[model samples]
Target: MKPQRRLRLGMVGGGEGAFIGAVHRLAARMDDRYELVAGAFSSSLENCQRTGAALWLDPARCYASYQKMAAQEADGIDVVAIVTPNFLHAPVATAFLQAGIHVICDKPLCLNAQQASQLAAVVKQSQCQFILTHNYSAYPLIREARQRVLSGELGEIRFVEVEYLQDWMSELVEQTDNKQASWRGEPAKAGAGCIGDVGTHAWQLASFVSGMLPQSLSAELATVVAGRALDDDVRVTLRYANGARGRLWASQVASGHENSLRLRIYGSEASLEFQQENPNQLWIRPRNAPAYCLTRGSGVLSDEVRTMGRVPAGHPEGYLEGFGQIYREAADQIWAAIDGQPFSGSLLPGIDDGVAGMKFIDAVRHSSMADGKWVDFSAA
Candidate 1:
């Protein structure tokens, strides 16, 4: 075995006050798998320069626009991390993929299903890896829950309930100076409201853990906040292909809830529940048996799940570490691809998952428009 090299990483669109951009940089740096060599941190030249100075990157490496960055830094960048708004995701990702750079993009894939398919095709042609940042799926307990479900400990899953609630949009914050809220509220920028922003996350987490995708769905989307164009609340019922049923509720107007993401799945013999707010514990209720908790770094966890944890049992690990796990696994796949080594099972969401999410978003919009009539969903 030999020492591995760090991937040269470039970023797009995480300037001052951008929350998720900092999260991506932190995740990429957490495991030392990638180095932030360059970035087009903002559309404005001044902001780009300021962000570059703040990150201590060489001033020459920061470009004013992603187009210039892609053209100029093509030879230097190994992976391009796109943390821009939803509308820019497709164009930025396509530009870098065409430049032969691998892409690690923030979620919802793109603004629409057409863009999703187009990017998927480009990735296949370029043979560059595309990793979608569905970060919740990387949690250690999520991995364990997935393992236990797959191992038949749950004995045929019957129902799934997933909700992602937040109070950030309870009022008309977009009318104020909230940068994050402003962009997400606009249909042109975000594509969809709560459904695209956090609903996709809830849907992805459920699919990741339950190993099932919805066959059909009926959705009700509402813009509860006055003067808002896009939806602020969403409720959907999912019918899986295997006869399993699920319900999902994603809302930014749920008062007093901040980043409350929780998932519960009930099977014939037992049930499992995990909450992002309390990420370390997984509650398991077995039929005719006492319910118990599965904690990260514990003896009962699978080897694969244990490896995702960084500390000893009972010590807490949260969002940053979970995000770091995805970064770690993505680095493995990218390195294997570059070295011509065989990559096994997927540890991170890929182009297919991105497309699937877009389809889910598309279906939700369609179903809501059709007065909550059932709409078929296929991840193909």
Candidate 2:
């Protein structure tokens, strides 16, 4: 294969000091597969120019609005990354997709299923790659877990449990001018607080590893913080078509925890556990046998599993590396299409997964709104 030029990348958001935006930029740069060239980094032209200059970008490429950025960069960039607030995701993504450019979007898809459906149409019409950044599933061990479940190493699945917890929003951080908390505390900008932000992540992780989407759900959403507008705590019970039962709990006011995302899956023959904080290790316990652990880059892992990690054994790679893997995989598919070739099958997620996540979020919201009543997942 001949060497190709780096893909030109643009952004809709991720202004200075924006946490997730910075992470996205870092991830894109990690594999040296893409180059940041233009963006509508902030609504304020001053902020946009400031960010562009700080990143050594050509100031002419920094626009005042996403609409202009999309139109101007349509023929200049290979892809655009959508890292805006929840409410803007759909429109920003639609603009870039309509411009015949690929998209890398931050998750929870959009505000609701309607927006998801609308984007689905745009995605299909454009025939452009739309990658959803469900970065957790890109971790080497997480991929290995998915492979194990697919290979029937876990036998008949019986149960699944997942949770995501964080303590930063335990108080009224929004009132203190905390950017993330400010937008998150408002439903208009955030859609649904903790549930959309992290619960969707837990839901996706469980489905990704277990290879199953639940058939129905009963959910309860609570605003643990006194005056919060949206839920900061969410609990959902899942029933699978194959008789598997699952539970998911996501909370932003969980007191002592910080990014404590965990998943446990139990099957007739074995069970496995993964904790995001302890990302390097995966524990497996087989019935009537000793439990063992698999660490990232472990020599015993299959060659495929080993490729998920960048560095060799004994090197710790977590959050950033996991995100980098997603970007790397996206570059592969994007480049394949650009070269007018049939791409090899890859696990990098796309539109269908995004739609499924939105459906789950909507189902949980509907169930909670109806007093924790069961909602058919099929209807979602």
Best by TM-score: 2
81-163 per-residue lDDT for model 1 (tens digits): 99999999999998999998989999989988988999899999989989999999999999999989998999988999999
lDDT of each: 0.91, 0.92
TM-score of 2: 0.98
Candidate 2 residues 1-380, lDDT tens each? 53378899998889986889899999999989999999999999999999999999999999989999888898999999999899999999999899899999998799989889999999999999999999998999999999898889999999999999998899989888799889888888988789899998999899999999999999999998898898999999999999999999999999999999999999999999999999999999999899999998678777887877788777888999989999998998998888887987678778899899889989998999999999999997
Pick out the ten consecutive residues of candidate 1 with the lowest summed lDDT: 1-10
Per-candidate TM-scores read 0.98, 0.98
What's the CA error at residue 278 for candidate 2, in Å?
0.7
- Cα misplacement distance, residue 1 of candidate 2 (Å): 2.6
